[model samples]
Target: MTGSRKSADALGEAETIALRVLGFIASTEDLFDVFVNASGVSADHVPTLAEDPEFLAAVLDFLLMDDRWVIDFAKAEGIAPEVVMQARAGLPGGDLPNWT
Candidate 1:
């Protein structure tokens, strides 16, 4: 689905929030636990979040701006440079009914 540039911009913000949240975790297990404890989201949401370009870029921006997490997310999440481009060209959030 297509959205106006403004809507895309908002999604970018949400993606940043999501990524910032992800960046806070200490490990993969912490990541899994975060999703497990999320109000209505699941672990599968990670890939969905990753596929959101606007969001991913915002997320990456968050990471880049935060010296603490910049290298950690890249290292722990196995986020490669090539995948970073795909992340920057992402779409939006997922189609899951219970998005949170």
Candidate 2:
């Protein structure tokens, strides 16, 4: 396979993980409200925002903020916890340096 194909596959996987995270957040009322508030995105706009790589990256970013959240989400999704960070790294703007 070519490099572009690999990149596309990685992006697709990352987007899938992000969508799962969004669903997980939506399933919990408090988390859903918190995500909406923190993202400054309305519930109605989520479907559209879900298509944006940057927005998807933000979803993973939010999920990564808490170790418990990552554990719960990974357990619920049957994915390893580290997969969340890998997915985040695959998304747009994820390659940027984090000076903090």
Candidate 3:
């Protein structure tokens, strides 16, 4: 039960990050345009694509590209900087780092 619940929480976190990623993208024309061009996501499809975990993961990955952007988004969204990292771990490529 605990493991399942934790899995649910992780999925929930990914969705939350998805929403914030949309919000962050919509706030900046340049960023939005860049995402659209690179992701091949048409503005018309945003409402649909935003719900996808893979799409959400892509958004997180996009944000992770730049520290300044990540910081800005965290500040605007009122979430801790670490929350983004946590959310990332819920995605396909988001394994915990092996800091040996």
Best lDDT goes to which candidate? Answer: 2
- Highest TM-score model number: 2
Give lDDT tens digits, candidate 3, residues 1-100: 6999989887897778867877898787599888888788888998888878878888888887788878888898898877887788897667857364
Q: lDDT for each of the candidates? A: 0.49, 0.93, 0.82
**lDDT digits (tens) for residues 22-42 of candidate 1:** 555524455446444643445
In candidate 2, what are the lDDT values of residues 1-98, reduced to their tens digit? Answer: 99999999999999999999999999976999999999899999999999999999999999898999999999998989999999998999889887
TM-score of each: 0.31, 0.94, 0.85
Models sorted by TM-score, best on top: 2, 3, 1
Off by over 4 Å in 3: 96-100
TM-score, cand. 3: 0.85
How close is each model in CA RMSD to the real structure?
A: 10.2, 1.0, 2.5
lDDT of residue 25 for candidate 3:
83
